[model samples]
Target: MTAAAVETKIPASAEWMRPGRVAVLLFAVLSLVAFLLPDGVLPAWTRQLPAEFRIGLDTWISAALKWLVEDATFGLFTFKDLTRGFAQLLNVPLDIATSILSTGLLDGRGSSAIQLAPPLPWIAVVGVVAALGYRFGGSKLALLAGGAFLYLAVFGQWASAMLTLSSIVVAAPLGIAVGLATGVAGYRVPLLRRIITPILDLMQTVPTFAYLIPILFLFGFGPVAAMIATMIYAAPPMVRVTMAALEGVPREIVEYGTMAGTTPRQMITKVMLPAARPQLLVGVNQVIMLSLNMVIIASMIGAGGLGFDVLTSLRRLDIGRGLEAGLAIVVLAIALDRLSQAYAAGARKRDAEGGLKPFLFGLAAFVAVTYLLALFVPPIATYPEALQISTAPFWTDAVKWINVNFFNVFDAVKTFILLNLLLPVKRFMMAQPWPLVAAMVGYAGWRLGGARLAALVVGLALFPVVTGQWDYTMMTVYLCGISVVVAALIGIPIGIYGGLSPRAWRVIEPAIDTLQTLPSFVYLIPAVMLFRVGDFTAMLAIVLYAVAPSVRYAAHGIRNVPTMLMEAGTSMGCTQKQSLRHIQVPVALPTILLGINQTVMLALSMLVITALVGTRDLGQQVYMALTKADTGKGLVAGLCVAAIAIIADRLIGAAAQKLAAQRSGAVDAT
Candidate 1:
């Protein structure tokens, strides 16, 4: 060992006992001081603050907002009326779809004039997918593609799944078409993109429930309205992705296309779109997952099928039915995702002769069986009662057991959370006075990024406070904070362990995917049963939903760190722990932070669904507004949630950018 190495190595130490010691000490002191203070300490402290510190003067503000909306809409713009109007408009498409199934020239009538449409011979759908898959990838992918369709059919959900699939089938293409056009528009006319970008940002961050109210109003409850709403919600990402992919296409390739005397349309279709195919497929995958996520929610306004059944079960507290329906959704989502992924993955491996013979044979066989069954077996469309499956009994028994045995303990935990944890956090944020908190957040942004990012942070953070939702807004923040913290506690270590080996990555990836795609509501049932309807349940739900991003990005970022650097650390006699702590972690921090940003967004999005656990937060406001048909109220609440999302996004994103730049600079210097 060298003398320099001996000098450089310090005595055994803990990171927590150094600079963080002061913070820990201060926390302890503050907690002690809080404990020593009288029960009226908060009230006295609040009294010392300026009057403007107060939030949400509800009655006056409500009246003023009502008047503003009335005046803005020329006295015919009440939210309820608007929702009613939307519902009426949406009814047309629902009526058409329903009438087609219920009354058309098709099947044997079942009571109401409506008769079920003969299921599309499964062979056709499968053949198209197989061909599409083969076109996208190759033989293995085509088989995977065929299998996904076969699973849907065998599972007896072929009919309803197809209905959901049809809407998405329609919405996905429409989204792609719109996104591609918009991407081109944005790329060509920067001004148009500039105008569209913020709306896109707002659309992505805003609670879907907020949009649902207005959509239901304009279109009325039905599949078409649901389709419209799904498109609106899911389209932005594709547009952004397509634009990015096109912009990133090599300048040389494009010039080659131009030099080849290709027309603009031909160049884009043959050159740009095909070249940008990979990213666009990613956008499509996003669209599929997002659309499926909304399947249950979309049913609220008349989009029917499994999602409707899921929602119905939720309302009835039939856990078996909810689980069955929710699992069905999960299975369908997995199937579509796998098929899409296989297609995309296979795109680079195009086959010579296209394996046309085998594919055609498979298609022929599938089609023959599907139509034959449709003709001979009426039961193919609807499964028999004996085949119906459920998980509701387990949930109900669990719910009852918890309620009976743990009610007092749960009550105490809830009270402690509300009175001690949540209340104190809320009061502290409120006590700071809005300007100070805004300034602090802005300053942090400036330190991490610069003036532009700081300005963005301030604007987003202040929006909700100015809108008079600061109190409930903070409640949402508190819940998110708890979830994010808990999730990080679990996720970061797992991510670290997973990043160490390919085997771990294989095990972790599917878990992450499952967590990522499982509908937000699915978590609500177990959370309510175990935790039993309080802040804790909501927090638990958020944590489970939010953990995936952290685990995914962390593992990805760490594993991707240059092996040469690890070798250098090894050459330096650094232990594995030291190499990871001092080398890998610093390099991976930016990506990990990116994961945290995603986790926060996911947690915020969970606000609407988690309200089943009884929160007094902004989501509850949105929920109440929905039931009361108060569009203005819902919009305001939705905006508050968006404000929280935007602020977190900006601050964390800026910090990550700064960290990446710092790491880059350090690398250059090395």
Candidate 2:
């Protein structure tokens, strides 16, 4: 060959031999071979770990937990006594909050024989909310705050909503306190951060139901168990956010505080924390949202209130009632989310006129007047039963109409998807020999990162096998894979369109926010109603629960792409489509991958919840363990789920890093 021709051939060969291209080609070949194999199954020898080699971690965990509860003691106290005492201590404040929000002390008999104040009148509650809203966020927020409470009252959900709020009032602060203290410790101690980081990751990824069983055993099934579970589930994010905020504090500011002779305690409380106020409040916001998300799930173990109402309505397939309760929850979530966000953003600026005193006086006067009027005007004290407007009938009719008119259409679409798309993908994945699957993941990890990541991926991929839960783990992989694919297909285009247009963004952003903030349980009800309870229904619920993050991140990434590049493309006579295809998407790929990572985490979290709708995945095992009080089984299953999450998170994170590096390289080349 001529020298020029040899050079051309060599360059082409090098391109094909690139690590990423080689990894993809290798994976594709193995997958294709696996698919063509008979019964779409691996050889029997390779299907699972040997029986003797399998670890009985669940058994050991169950035994340990039992010993702790029944036999273990510290000085004079057993674990049961300690747990019971703590439960009793927590319940005192919970009972006080519930009574004040619901029945009021004046209307009920008490052991102490001290008459307490009655529940604040609905009108007074509205006035106070509006006043606080106006003080923080002006007239628009005032309307939103007042309107949400009014809807709760007028819809006759006042008692249930208040009950839920009472729990949140306690749970949120407890989560914040625990989270802040842990976060501070983690920040100050490097060794603690190293230990806490992985624990936090696992705690955040493990399904909430996994811990509920242990809590149920210790605290018994009631509000106290639910409260503890909620706190555990909600506090991780707060800790993470707090640590990040503290870490992000400018070194200059810390130095200034030090030079000013501030003590360590004063440095943290007066200087560091104040400077990190925005992020601290963001952590608070996260705690509130997570607590609210747990409301309905916590109800399964006997936490009462609106969540209980929603659960009951759904169990009966009472669409209208479920919808009403769901809407109320959404409203509550939005109101709290917005108020906290506004406060964190420092929306409140002290007014020159009267500052804080007049606002306090006005609030007191509103309370007194409303209380006095409630003594005579019954509707002001409690929303009048006669005037209550129930939307349950309307929602019930809507559900019926949807079932009657669209049943065949939905069924046909569902059949096509299951038969043609989801089933085949699942079979392909399940068919692979475990060793081959692990190798493929390891190769991809190595291509993106290096040998260390390859080892990590292989270890995580083999985790379920060693634990003797390989089959259930594969089932979870199938569900998560299908849900993520569908979510991306639907969400990415909407995100791109919205990103490209201001008007569309304005309309789309709020809808995405609403979808994200709505409790995960609410999605399940509609899925069940529309499709009935099965794998498809479960997948549908996962898709709805997980799609919002994809849309949000996609839009944010595309929109944030440098404007100069788009203009340059225009100047070069490139069409908008060309610009989007060739420039915007490439730049945004890293961010979009992060979105997919979030979607994976969300789908895994929903796995156990979706199991409630009947699917024989690992989630079902967790649910079964919960019912049987098998702590070992539940924890093992939960850990398998967490393992899956860790694998996906690591792989996606590595891929995103690679993409970011490539983008930087391309920029430098230009």
Q: Candidate 2: which pairs clash?
A: none
All predictions: root-mean-square deviation over Cα?
5.6, 4.1
Output the lDDT of residue 180, model 1: 75
In model 2, where is the ten-residue run with the lowest total lDDT?
Answer: 5-14
State each model's CA lDDT, in order.
Answer: 0.72, 0.85
| TM-scores, one per candidate | 0.82, 0.94
State the lDDT at 94 in candidate 2: 83
Measured with C-alpha atoms, the lDDT of residue 281 in candidate 2 is 89
The TM-score obtained by model 1 is 0.82
How many Å off is the CA of 509 in candidate 1?
Answer: 1.6
Candidate 2, superposed: residue stretches over 4 Å from native: 1-17, 39-42, 106-117, 351-354
Tens-digit lDDT track of model 1 for 82-164: 65565566445544544333232334334654444454455566676776666665677678776666665665556666667
